[model samples]
Target: MPLKELAERRAILHRKSDPQTIVKHALDDVQLGKVAMVSSFGAESVVLLHMISQTAPDTPILFIDTEMLFPETLQYQKDVAEELGLTNVQVVKPSREKLLEQDVDGILHTIDPDACCALRKTQPLEDALEGYDAWITGRKRYQSGSRAELPVYEKSGRKIKINPLADWNAAKLVAYIEEHNLPKHPLVARGFQSLGCAPCTTKTKPGEDPRAGRWRGQDKSECGIHIVDGKVVRQRNAA
Candidate 1:
């Protein structure tokens, strides 16, 4: 279950079939009641969530509630879950002791965003994902820097990571949302192209990169939840 072996296993799976095939295979092969989906409830998350809800409504949907997130995000999460009729939308949160120990100053995001993300997102997710054999994600290829090369299926230790939207683009996402009359995050229309924690996100201007607002002014971009190889590489830092 080492990182290297996991990557090797993921590579082998990727070579065997395309992304769509991988998703179908995972859905069919993974044991019932043992799978879950991790959703950010961001700009384009509804597409995959809808797909999963239709394909497997009973599957548990895990949403991380980092206390630093915008209030609008929390509302949107509820709306989306209700609209989609998601049966099991469990909200995972970081433990108070862990947050107090790591973010006692409440300014860790400004001084050390990586560590803050590790505490709020990575560690909490690692804990939430325990006992699951496979999980679904909403990653797409045309999203940003590193995500442009995302694979459909990956191996994370002993668990299977499935990206059902790996081949989707921004235009397709928007189109699907509109066609379905899905509710969007309020910040999306206000120029916040990419939404994350309140302080880490900003509104972008025309011609500016969609993710430019994330960790603005700083070299930091991703929150380290999605890693590559054995190291934690941010989405913006890659490629």
Candidate 2:
């Protein structure tokens, strides 16, 4: 389908529909063709994951392990999946050959963060999403500047990216988690409101944006996973 039509469909989907309804529509619609849920298992992630679990327990949940993530995140991924009974949780990782060729020492993030994220995140996720026509995300408008206008469905490359929580805010997320008794990522307690690979992630300061810690002191906001108008909008920080 053309991008314009997809936008129209997104408008219809967003009209009077809640987060769980969007998730259910994506998973149950055969036209979507092999849907998967991509999650970082970060703070506020369990809300969407829990929605997916309740909607469809066996939905494919792709968790990218950049291999540089915090040990806490790694354990949290396992714990959340088991706790939610998410049977098809797939642990995706950067390619061994690609890592050897590009970031053998795993310090590429220190030199060029965008290139590092492309290698460790974008490319690996592209590979993992090869056969899928649609994928779900836990992204919200409150996350970052780039995602401030996030839609319920977006056209990314050849796939339809679904953001069920696009309209959600921090308060709603907390309430949902509290009501569901969902597990939170361990690092959130340490001030890491937005979790990513350990090397680029730091604890956010009080009154700062939740994503302030990611790629701190850098002009980067997103990790290159978010594509807009068929282009990667990785560095959205303007001088």
Q: Pick the candidate with the highest lDDT.
A: 2
- Cα lDDT listed for each candidate: 0.76, 0.86
TM-score of each: 0.86, 0.95
For candidate 2, write residues 1-239 as lDDT tens digits: 67557755875767678998888888888767789999999988899989988989898888999999999989999999999999999999999999999999988999999999999998899899997988999888887777777788878877888888888989999999999999988788888889999999999887677788888898889888878766877655422
Give a tens-digit lDDT track for model 1, residues 1-239.
65345545655665656444655556776342267889989877778778777777767888999899999899999998888889889899988998888897678888888888888888898889897877888887775676777776666555667786788777888888898888888888888877889988888877676677888877777787776543676545332
Model 1: residues with Cα > 4 Å off, grouped in runs: 1-25, 31-33, 235-239
Worst 10 residues of 2 by lDDT: 230-239
Error of 1 at 83 (Å): 1.0
